[model samples]
Each structure stands twice: as C-alpha cells, then as structure tokens.
Target: MSLIDNINKAFDHRIRLGIMSILMVNDYADFNMLKELLGATDGNLASHTKALEKEDYIKVEKQFIGRKPNTRYSTTPLGKKEFQKHIDALEKLIGK
Candidate 1:
C-alpha cells in the first residue's frame, strides 16, 4: 500500500476530512464550533470525533464554560504529522 492509501483510510468520508481540515489550523475548537463549521449533527460529529480519537489522531478536551459542558478538539502532534503527510500524499496523487 502507498501513502495515499493511508490518508484515504484516515478520511474515508468527506465529513471526516472536513473535520480534520478545520482542526489543522485552529489550536482548539469546541463541539458546537465544529458542528457549525461542518454543518453536521451532534451525533454525526460525535461519532466521527470518537473514531479519530480512537486512532490517536486528535485530542479531545472536555470542560465547562459557565454552567454547560463543552468538548473541544485539537490535533495531537502525531495527528499534525499525519495530516501533513496526508496532504503530501494527496498532492502526489494529483501529480503535483
């Protein structure tokens, strides 16, 4: 298997890709923020985030702001490296 195969596996769905892309730039973003950005349902985002977290691809921090609890996401150092590699793999696939 090649590198693209790895990235392809990482982002099997476009929703997953969108999630990672958003987390790449920002240091941290909450569940609501991600849902707003991706236009995804809570269940949808939660499921995908759980998948990434299981893979050790993203770090999740849960805390409360005022009275309500929030889940914030940020790419782990390992995740950051993997995402960059994924991008490079995509560029290769595009013949760049």
Candidate 2:
C-alpha cells in the first residue's frame, strides 16, 4: 500500500497527533495537561479528544478531585498499534 494510504486520517491534525503522542508515553493525561501541552484552547482539545474517543482510539476517565471534575485520556492498544504503523509509514516514505 502507498504511504498516504497508511497514514491514519484520525491523527492527521497536529493537535490530535499531539494528543496521541502524549498518551503514548503517558499513562494518562488530564484535559488541562493536554490543553497546556498542545497549546490548544478548550474547544479545540475537547473536539479532537471526542473524535479520538469516538474512534475507540483512546479511553477517557472522568472523576472528581476535591469536588472538581477531572477528565483524563489514555491510548488504547489498538491506538498504539495504529499510531506505530502510521509512524513507520512516514519513515518509509522518507526512506529513513
């Protein structure tokens, strides 16, 4: 298959890619952490995160910390595999 075909459309955007990349290395990251790390606004991060959740690429956990709501995100096994494949495809395309 072509490299472009291998690239996951779900991770095409920089913010979404950043989210996945962070979740790949981190056990879980809260909404604020992701927003800060990606430098994204609340709406932007929430929309992208929802997309990933809809794809089943990530799992979301919501809890209360001191009466405050906290939302955390982590990558699923399928997401990890798909992300690795996308990375590999990019490397191959670059002849790396």
lDDT of 1 by residue, 15-90 (tens): 7888899999999989998999899998988999999998898999999899999889999998888888888888
**Per-candidate TM vs. native?**
0.91, 0.96
In order, what lDDT does every prediction score?
A: 0.86, 0.94
* Tens digits of per-residue lDDT for model 2, 1-96: 677899999999999999999999999999999999999999989999999999999999999999999999999999999999988888898999
Q: For model 2, what is the C-alpha lDDT against the true structure?
A: 0.94
Residue ranges of candidate 2 with Cα displaced over 4 Å: none
Scored by lDDT, model 1 comes in at 0.86
TM-score of 2: 0.96
Error of 2 at 58 (Å): 0.4
